[model samples]
Target: MHSKTYILISFHTAELGNPDIVFLISIVLAFTFIMFLTCEILLQGSLRDHSEPNDEYVIPHGDWFEIVSSPHYLAEIVIYAGLVVASGGTDLTIWLLFGFVVSNLVLAAAETHRWYLQKFESYPKKRLAIIPFAY
Candidate 1:
């Protein structure tokens, strides 16, 4: 996703040299880059990845399951949004926008549903999937 954003930025600015659009694209790219970096360090993987097979689920243990499970989806949206804003009113921009939204929605919904199934028997019965109460 990050590579794709970089590709779009390079191609568009090289071919068209639109300063204003390039500036906006640069802003989005910077923000998304920061987000990815932060997520990389802060995001804890699944409990099984961090712990022994015989270990029990507990306070900090559950936290290891997912700091934020849908990060890749989030990155995809940011990349496509950056592309759309960079391309302005082009057909590619519009199609990318639609595809991003639809794909994110589908993936987020499926992940949330899968999360519920996996965590149903866990201690944190109150923990809602995905977007807190909104999910």
Candidate 2:
């Protein structure tokens, strides 16, 4: 949906003659990619670390897990935000797409966090659902 929204907006706004807008898009894309990669790596590493044979589930630690229960979901939100920025930040469809993505991810993350708390006795109490410091 994010890619489709970006492509649709780009095609519709093909006459974007502002170099600053292009630069902003480029920077946003780069930052989004980096943030996504970092979150994914952290999530993957956490999963791998807990993949050992065990009778009980282990709460993932390290990286953003120290702050949020679902870093991957946060990364997903960041990706959609980047798409919105790349779509020139004024397209109603892109904004709606971003809002949808954010809402769904937040809901999923909140549920995951609740499950974690219920399933594990050592779950971090300070962690938010998805966003750091604020849910």
Candidate 3:
């Protein structure tokens, strides 16, 4: 039901624009969708089924986790930025979109880094928490 609602919303919102705008939006949306799905599939076994309480906890089976921490939140930023870009070049929207992406990336990176440090004291010193290489 939730996924259905998301699809419907995307469809309706995608339609509320000029044909050219819609076409561009469709491309951005497609990119966001494909990237998200690909990431999910690639990290399937590693994803947790339930969200833990808002507290520090040891993540079991480090090998099995889709995101080191909060990839969904990052994806949300990507999705929204794509939408704003697709909606045409709105200065305010672009600024907000970029801000959202940067903020989420920063927060997710920090949280994931801390989790890695605590969850695996011996985690490969070279392995980054979120963005690969020099996060």
Which candidate number has the best TM-score? 2
Q: What would the per-residue lDDT of candidate 3 be over residues 61-86, giving only the tens digit for each residue?
A: 34313334444445556776776776
Tens digits of per-residue lDDT for model 2, 1-135: 999978865754565766567767889999999988997799779877854588766788888889899998889889999999877788999999899999998999999999998988878899999989888
Worst 10 residues of 2 by lDDT: 11-20
Tens digit per residue, CA lDDT, model 1, 1-135: 999988976887887677677787668778867756644543444333554555544332234124333444455556556556555647775876668695766577557657655765653554333433444
lDDT score for candidate 1 against the true structure:
0.56
Superposed by TM-score, candidate 3 places the C-alpha of residue 48 at a distance from the truth, in angstroms, of 4.9
Predictions in order: lDDT: 0.56, 0.86, 0.61
State in Å the error of residue 6, model 1.
Answer: 18
Model 3 segments beyond 4 Å from truth? Answer: 1-25, 39-44, 48-73
Worst 10-residue lDDT window for candidate 1 reads: 58-67
Residue 31 C-alpha lDDT in model 1: 80
TM-score of model 1 (CA atoms): 0.49
